[model samples]
Target: MQKIGFSGTLDPITNGHMWVIGEARSIAEEVVVFLSENSTKAPKFSAEERKAIVLASCAERGWNNVAVQIVKSEYTARVAKRNGVGYLIRGIRSTADFDYENLIQQTNVEVIGGAKTLFVMPPRDLGSVSSSFVKALEGPVGWNWTMKKFVPAPAYKAWILAWLRKEWDSLWRERPHSAEWFERLTGEQAYGGAERHYHNLDHLVHGLAEIRAWAANTGAAPAHVALVKAAFWFHDAVYAHAAGEVSNEEASARLWLGSGLEPDAVRAEEVATLIRATDHFQGGAMLHPLKDTMLSVDLAILGQEAEVYQAYATGIRAEYAHVPEADYNSKRAQILAHLRGKAEAGTLFADPFFTDNYTAAAIANMSAELALIAGR
Candidate 1:
């Protein structure tokens, strides 16, 4: 065929969608990605945004034969025919998907002078990879690594930024100065700074997930939940590129205090204190439950699966790229040794839940990392 059309809403465009596009490209000299609008449900990205993501992926793949266009009408046959598309390509992941798409295939083929339907299936491993499935991985720890496997190269970072925007918007939907506050936190000089490999907004997403998960289990009050969420959001808001110069926790706490949310004096001070608790070295004296929860969640990466912990350690190293390897490794080993001492003393995690679940894993992870650092 001279031309084939691949049509869908493609809210964020996953690898599964790309597989179908590849199939279309293989069968036709040219492929048109028809980004259609669905009025029944709102999409995460607009037509133009989705088109941009698709185009980026196409460019990344060096697909000169592919093009993207927004389609206004829901009817696929007339649109495909008008575009000179000889076939409309669709992806079938399972019998259920085939059942749904077969009806559309019949409709298109029945239309006078309309394009024929071409059904393609991705690899079995990608059968379950959908836009929604990829979207669900946005907040959990080590999500970036997992998401990278499913998203196209060009869309991975874009997806993270969009997810962060949504999360930041949701966090401050009812609050004042949201726009200004979010900009500062995500700007190049702050959490979104290029140096923030480990302490970036994605880290906040993981922390927020931990908070919500804790709340879900403990039935914590909404106020406490809100406080902790906000604290987590702004905890690393002002990470300086160099570690242990000025207190990043103190600066971030100040940023949170003056963030224009208009919290009363007590609330503001309490939040500042909560933010400061992230500075693990200055934190042993803290005995409050909320404080304990914040500290534990912030350190929870140490207890994540082995691969995730290794990634976290590598990111931390990347952030301190200015330092010489020997000095960096020496300082890192010192910090790990300090934390290991705390873990051995049975005071590494304060929250009883984390103390029981994460303390041992955290110790093991840190010790392993420490050994690696020493060997180097």
Candidate 2:
């Protein structure tokens, strides 16, 4: 257990890989990660880039006992022998993994003679995570939160920043914007404000994911999906810090209106209308499927699991912490009660998609939260 080896291409390291590393770290004095370079492998990230990322991830977690060795065209056992590492850590998440890894372990110890393979499995929640899975979440809908859970902190940071750049580049592909506009939109003045604990870029990413999921379910055309996505981008971009006269939604919509994402002013207006639906207090119903879809998606967090709901509520409370507690509690109670009432009336979600998935859970979360506020 003095020295141990963990080997993989690790095109990019993931949380699950970190789990196994933690296991090796627990027993070993030093854990050396063998970042293998196979001639035939076409990895997403180069070896040097992956090594820096892995080292940064270790730094992020304050894991000082870990080290890395770039293995070029060498066998794992030979590397282990060269490094004087007696044990190699292998992850087994399933019966198939066990069957495969067990064979390898036997071969390494009995047949190969240089290293003994120690098998470890992550907790069931992390059982399925792999680099391939993490890589696949890059451009997809509904993956920012999911990807955050799977990737290490440093890699996640790199990933989200990269994703933001790619997203904006795609947004402005047809209609180009200055570097300053991109910064203004994605940086602190907009969604990335210091005051924003929630409603930030990640939230926008989640909303985009949800809408695309909605599109896939409803078989929405590319145009409609694009319109809804535009609405999502500008919906919370001007959150809370309104310029005195206009509401946040109006401010955000005005930005969209000026931007030529959609040449048609009418469609731009539709995006605006959809953005306006995010204002929970404005009781007027927009009453179109697309609008309702936007509304449902905007509030979709309400219908998520208790943990996600709690996180959402906590973020909302954090954002409104400047308000006097009594006033904040009172105002929040009213909104929660209104939602509770809506839930009881089976009108909590406008889209049947969300209505079916989130209705009961949303009601339950609101009711529990309301009880806490009342008691407080």
Candidate 3:
């Protein structure tokens, strides 16, 4: 099977790139889109986000033979050769594009003796669409119905969420003592730790974003919002990598109480209670609204799309690398089965926001994972 390489920043993949990928598919048995980063040029999205967008786009289009990857090196020819790609594909929309790509093609040929570069010109309708053009339309007011035509649905959704996250981060930066302080402290504990993979800074950020959105829409009280945010930060602060050794939730809550981040004894106790609610092992009714919200947010990963959920599962396995596979799968299945039961009962989340939007998907994802583990 012949493998073809397509390299670009793909900041936000456009219809033009899809057209070129289709053309590459016709010529090569397998196609890999390399989400390359250039030091001289600033990217609108991170490399990981770009790769996810590409993968999601491919999944939506049913492009089974196309794979998306992040390229660490700027040397295109060497990357292609290392990936077993025999040909490199580039799209040319005009004379300028042709002129620019021709120079790179010549250099690539010299770098990899036997590799080839193929130029594809998109159809007239898509020729004008580019990443730069899509990026220009990115803003709170610019992403309208018309802008949707140029980008794939999955990519557009990912880009919008990423943009929203950036805005939220900026807003928190302005108030460094509150949201930003928790962000920095939790970020260090989660991302800098050696045993973290799934329950890391990114996971906390996602949880915070979800809670913020829900709080905004529901007109939640400022105090309630603050409490939930604190829970999100400390829920997994002391992630226990091994199974059944100690309760991470308890340790995290104790750490939060002693840190003096929240000196008020009453609110500090509330935050600790919310963090313990995330321990799905102790199944029971939530004692308060804040605890309910925190529990739902912690289980939100169950409702993500299949690809994203699969990645979450993979990260979790990586975190428990010390555990034997059979034992790990057994423990994981038990937890998922418990969640699945709650999901099926329509009581997974006390909040209407999560119950209405995520209940069905969460149940389905948990069932799927349980089956996979059983089969293995």
Candidate 4:
């Protein structure tokens, strides 16, 4: 059976809300609704009241297959991860909503690592219905004016009353959390408007994949694994490609601390260190105790040990396909030279499995990739 989860404050249920839930039900055998608690910046509704309204609204439609409750704490992603719910559900009504929702989904994937997102578009008729509009006395007229046009009267009344008391606005209009904040502040340009040579969705996926490979090969200590994974996310997070001075270690550490991940400050710092160690020009003399795994990851790419490296290159080429070939060639050359030096010096990666074999594999792979790129 599929276990699906729903999040958000239901200050008032709107036709749009119901439509998403219906879509979720069609895909999974069970739908679990977790009401969001209003933070200082969110709307002002108690968890219990929101739960009641959600249950009442679901009952009106005989949605017995769904289990409704409040999601505790501000860490909704953590809560959902603990529950073993793989998919986080949301409904999109317009292009604006899609942009915001996309960031939330991206952040969850970053923090949780394994979760996926499912976006269900609102039913055609209820496309414009939203909790914010329902709550605004002037935004949209009587609930039935739209409800009868899209939703049942009872459900519509339940939705409006929930919002009338100002409960739903708690989660709405709040400052976005981590990933959301990143997307809002950033644009298509990576650094100095150089068009971002690296650090894209593909980079993130590659980091996670390398971490996964390391975890599988050596079963590294769990704490170390978590730290490494988190580092994979924060590293290169502050990319200013044009300046060529981004600190995967320093900036990522600050990001972790700023995001309230201070409890693991030391570990976060270590990961940042590892990220910096991945710098092609950086040598092993400055390596730290965590250097082995970090280097292993860096070499995993520098050495082109697997198809992952090629994939990374392919993504970069595609992203900058518009750039002048001369510019691409110059940047690509510097990157390859950096990789070659690291591999040649036996410092590109730290091999945890045997201290030699893993490094050897990486060097061999990277050599072939470098040669291929040069010939091209």
Candidate 5:
């Protein structure tokens, strides 16, 4: 099974690129789309954002064989060679595109031994549509229906949601207590905040999914489940970039309590206790059943498969990017050591669900992370 590579900035994936990816998928067993960064061009979107857009586009179009990756190197040839891609796929629109790509093809072949370049013309209707042209439509005038036609539907929806985030205040005023408002506020704090990397909306969503699964499995009461859901939303709402300096759980709890959204004092306290229980290192006395469940769900990431755990570690490091490597590693090791101690003592999770399913894997992940941090 030969892997074909397609490398592009993909700042905002266009319809043309989707068509080209579909064409490439037909020609190769696997199509790897390298979201390459270009030093010469100022990207409208970050590398991570572009990769996500491409991935979403692939998923939307049901391109099962296509995979999206963010290239560390700006050079496409280097990306192809690193990924063991034998052929580089390029989409050519016109004579000008052919001439430019022809030069690139020769250079790539020269730099990467045994690498071949394949050019495919996009559908005639979308041939001239490019990311640059699509970006031009996004100005003070804002995106219109015509602009939506040029880009993938998922990309356009993401763009519109991002645009809407800036106008959240107006939207909030119009629909207070609405799910959209709740999502917008949570999304802003989690995904749009500067410090968040791992404790983002995606993490919150994962927690919610786990909580729901556990609740259903255990036949938890509706009120108890609702409190758990609230705790999930506020657990990492106020993430602290610096380690051991401040308590994000406490801060997040306070934010939720003072938000004028809580039903009553008792319920607020329950949710607050649940959020604070996520402070795994503190090892405080548990007061509520939901606390045990929430804590288990929060630490579930530790029990994920190796690749998922690695990704979580990477995101945590990114969150603490401001800290020096040595300092970060030392702090991280201390945290992991505490978790390891709990796991060793058989007190990591009070909930049977987590004890039966996650305890062993969590301990294993902690041990691996501790060893890695020790070397650093």
Candidate 6:
């Protein structure tokens, strides 16, 4: 009853492909290898030939519960579910592949309710070996490229090409300013979520807007403004289905690098580092360049007048509504704890506007909110 499925086309499976299958087989009671067709990519063999080769390969290795079959449909999840398979396996070789594959896994869940995708990282020795590289050299270089020795007989080169092509298409097509792109890239929308989930595009934009206003009021340095604004947009770039604490920082760097911002690499790196520093809410002790940036971002929420604070705060609550109640509560507590801890340590607000008039205002605003939960 332990059925596992692998969907690919074996034009010439590589050693990396075979390694993943070997590892998958050890963990599954039965392995169903599905040779996918209807691919718009290079194919060196017919689907029937590839299926037979896969069967022979599994048999040669004496692997039980290994069956090779063809799936004509494009839906890998539907095929797996029909076969009573519970696991969808993918092979990851690099960070780029991981990012691309992670998106697919998230989409699969949406496409097929309860379907899961598990990625197995290829061993370091085989990390750089891919079918594409081999195929590109096979014809002109006159090199033998039969993947039977390295890949399972059922491995489909066409399927991998299609997967890569699809990923590339999506990546190239993504619009930086499109709400549709935002939904496709991340499960969350720019606005309207739970209180604990308030950090989104709108929140980031709001934070930057406030940063600009605070800068204008205080005559802040231009470099500080640019760094802060870049961090605001890039901070959430690496968000995935199961993002963790450092997701913001990681994504920031990825976005900066992908955007070919290398000439400003130092500043971009500093921006990423500053965003990470914001996670710690100690008032003034934050790292040099970004400590002020963090205060600006934080104060942007609580330093406003009562009317402005209430209006922004309402939107903040809605942005986080999708977050589970428990998670929402925990994050809210963390933010509050950070604020309290920062104030106690004398690091909460260091900028001129905050140092002069907004410091007490920010504290008073959060104090009221904290008191609401403190008594509960």
User: Which scores better on TM-score, 4 or 6?
Assistant: 4
List per-prediction Cα lDDT, in the order shown: 0.81, 0.81, 0.76, 0.60, 0.75, 0.60
Better of 1 and 2 by TM-score: 1
- Between which residue pairs do clashes occur in model 5? none
Pitting candidate 3 against candidate 4, the one with the higher lDDT is: 3
Cα error, residue 315 of model 4, in Å, equals 2.6
TM-scores, all candidates, are: 0.86, 0.77, 0.56, 0.42, 0.55, 0.41
Model number with the top TM-score: 1
Which RMSD does model 3 reach against the true structure?
Answer: 10.6
Residue 1, model 4: Cα distance from true site in angstroms = 37
List the lowest-lDDT window of 10 residues for candidate 1: 280-289
**What number of backbone clashes does candidate 2 have, counting pairs of residues 3 or more apart or in separate chains?**
1
Tell me how many clashing residue pairs each candidate has.
0, 1, 0, 6, 0, 21
Total backbone clashes of candidate 6, pairs 3 or more residues apart or in separate chains = 21
Q: Give lDDT tens digits, candidate 2, residues 1-376.
A: 6899998988679988898998999999999999998889898667887888899998888899999999998778777977799889988889998998888777777776768788887898889899998988776545676687788877776667666666666656656564556677778888767788788777877777787688888898887887787788888888774346877877787887887666777787888888877765452765445887888888888877787778778989899888898998999999999987887788878788888878999999999898889999
lDDT comparing candidate 2 with the true structure: 0.81
Q: State candidate 1's TM-score.
A: 0.86
| Candidate rank order under TM-score | 1, 2, 3, 5, 4, 6
TM-score of 3: 0.56
Worst 10 residues of 5 by lDDT: 167-176
Residue-level lDDT of model 5, residues 1-376, one tens digit each, is: 4788888888788898888888888888999998877666778678888888888888887777888877765576776776798788888899999999998888877855545788998778997899888878753321333466798877876665554444333223343464554664456565546567778644655566576677777899878887887787777777765555557777777777876566578888888888878765553765776677888888877877676677789989998788899999989898889987888787777678877877888888889988888776
Per-residue alpha-carbon lDDT of candidate 1 for residues 45-95, written as tens digits (9 for 90 to 100): 778888888999998889889898888855766788887887888888999
Off by over 4 Å in 2: 1-3, 26-29, 37-49, 70-73, 79-87, 92-99, 102-151, 156-174, 178-195, 240-245, 257-270, 277-289
* Root mean square deviation (Cα) for candidate 2: 4.2
